[model samples]
Target: MRRVIKNDDSEVKKSNLGYIEGNSNNNLKISKILYKEQKGFCIYTEEYLGRADARDIEHFDPTLKGTSDDSYSNWFLVKHQWNKEKSSKWADYQPVLHPTASDFNERIVYDDGDYRVSELDDQEAINLIKLLKLDDIILADERKKYIQRKAKELSIYGVSPEDFFKILIDDDIKQISYLRAIHEEFKIDIWNLLPNPQ
Candidate 1:
C-alpha cells in the first residue's frame, strides 16, 4: 500500500463525508474520491481496482475519538476483501500506519515484487501485514504482473527504471512503494538511488 493524498476534503463534497448527507451511498461517494487518490487501487494491499472488485468504506477513527465514524477525516476506501478481513480493533490493534500520520514508503519495503517490513524486527508492522494478509499469493501474483507490465511499458518510453520509480513517488501516485518493488525486481541498473526507507 502507499500513502494517499486525500482530495474530497474539499469544501464542496464535505457534506458527502458526514452529518448532512444521510445518504446510503455515502460510502460509495467516498469510495470514488479514494479511488481517484489511489489511482483506482486498493488502500491496504495496493491491488488495482477491477470492474468486478468492490470497495469498502473504512473508518479510520473506528473508536469514535472525538467524533462519529462518519466524520470527514475518518473515512477510507478499501477493497471489500480487505475490509472484511480486517475487523475492528482498539488502539493496541491499530494498523502499522495511518494515511495522514504514517508514510508507507518508509515503513514498507518492496523487492522481488513483495511488500515486506523495511525493518525486520518491526513486529507491529509485521502484525499489521498478517492481520490484513497483504502478502497473500493472490495479491503477490497481481503485483508481479504489474511489475512486468510497468517495467516494459516504461522501457518503451525511454524512461529508465530509476526515473520511472522516482516519478511515481514524486507524483504521489498511490501504491508508490509497490511500484518501487517493480523497479527493484526489473531494474538492471549499476546506478540510481535505491528505495529509501528513511
Candidate 2:
C-alpha cells in the first residue's frame, strides 16, 4: 500500500495543484468521485454555481472575508487548467472508455448574474489514481486485457494481474476511510448517491 502523508508538502509540488479553500475539508469526497469514475475527473459546477458566484457575495463573505474578486477569478482559472491536465494524462494512458465533458466557459452564469471562480492543482493525481479504482478495475477480465494491450502499445510499465487485484482491494479500504474523514469534517451528505462501503 502507498503511504500518503496527509500533510506532505512534497506531493503538493509534484501535483502542482491548488484547491478552493472552503472545499479543502471535502477533498476526500472529491477523491472518491475521481477514483470510481472512468473519466478520472469530476466537476461540481452546477452544485457550486450559486454558492461560489460573486453576486451571492454575501454567501462567501463569511469564508472569504476581504478576498478580492480577482483572487477568486484566478483560482477558477487554475482549477480548470489543473483538471484539464489531469484528464489529458488519463486519456493518454487508458482506453477512451471514460470521456469527460468540458466545463470551462468564457463566462459563468449564476442566479446573481455574477461569475464564480475556480481553483487548480496537480496534487490530486495520486489521489485521483486511487479514486478512479483503475488499479483494481484493470485486474478485471475485459478491463485487464484492454489495459495490458494498451500499456504494451504505449510502451508503458504494466502491473502484474495479481498485484493489480491486490491494489484494488487495498485502495477500496483506503478510499472508504478517506471518505469517512471528509464526511465528518465537512458535514456533507457525500454518501447519498455513492455506493455503500463494501
Candidate 3:
C-alpha cells in the first residue's frame, strides 16, 4: 500500500459523522471525498475504483466505527472484497501499518507480484500482507499480466520509457492499479514521475 496523505481541509473532516447511524447520504458524500483523496485507488489493493469493481468504506480501526471515536482519520476507501475478507480479522492479527500515518515503502517492499516486509522480523508488516491478501493468486496474476503488457508496449519501436512512464502516471488516461508492483517491475519511482511532483 502507498502512503495516503489525508487532506486536513477536506469537507468531511470539518464535520462529525460519529453521531450519525446508517446515514446513507452522508456515507456517499464521505465516499466521494475519500475516492478523490485516495486518487481513485483502493487503500489496500491499490486497484482503480472503476464501475466494474465494487467498493466500500473501510475503517482502519474497525472497532471505532460505531463508537464515539469514529472520525475521518479512521476511514478509508477499499475494495469490497478486501473489506469483506478483512472483516473481524484485525483483532486476531498484529496492528498493521496505517496508510495515513506510516511510510509504507519503508515498512513493506513489493517484488513483482509479491509483498514482503522490508525487515524480515516485522510481524506487523507480515500480518498486514496476509490479512489483506496482498499477494493473493488472483491479484498476483493480474499484476503479472499488467507487467507483461506494459513491457511489450515498452518494446515497441520509438516508445521511450520516459513517455511511457508518463502514461502510467497519468490519471486522466487511467487510474493506476498494482502501482508498487509496476514500480518494482519497471524500476521507476512513481513519485518522481508525477506530472506535478508533490
Can you list the residue pairs that collide in candidate 3?
none
RMSD of 2: 18.6
Q: Which ten residues in a row have the lowest lDDT in candidate 3?
A: 189-198
- Residues 113-172 of candidate 2 have per-residue lDDT tens digits of 222222223223323333333233322233334334533633443565334334433545
All candidates: TM-score: 0.63, 0.17, 0.84
Instruction: Kindly indicate the candidate among 2 and 3 with the higher lDDT.
Output: 3
lDDT of 3 by residue, 15-96 (tens): 6544256888878888877887776778888777776778989888888878878888888889898999998788887767
The regions of model 1 sitting more than 4 angstroms off are 7-13, 19-22, 65-70, 88-95, 149-198
Task: State the RMSD for candidate 1.
Answer: 7.4
Clashing pairs in 1: none
Number of the predicted model whose TM-score against the real structure is largest? 3
Better of 1 and 3 by lDDT: 3
Clashes of 1: 0
- On residues 30-127, what C-alpha lDDT tens digit does candidate 1 reach at each position? 56666665556566765556668787766655565335455655666678877776665435554455555456667766657667888888776676
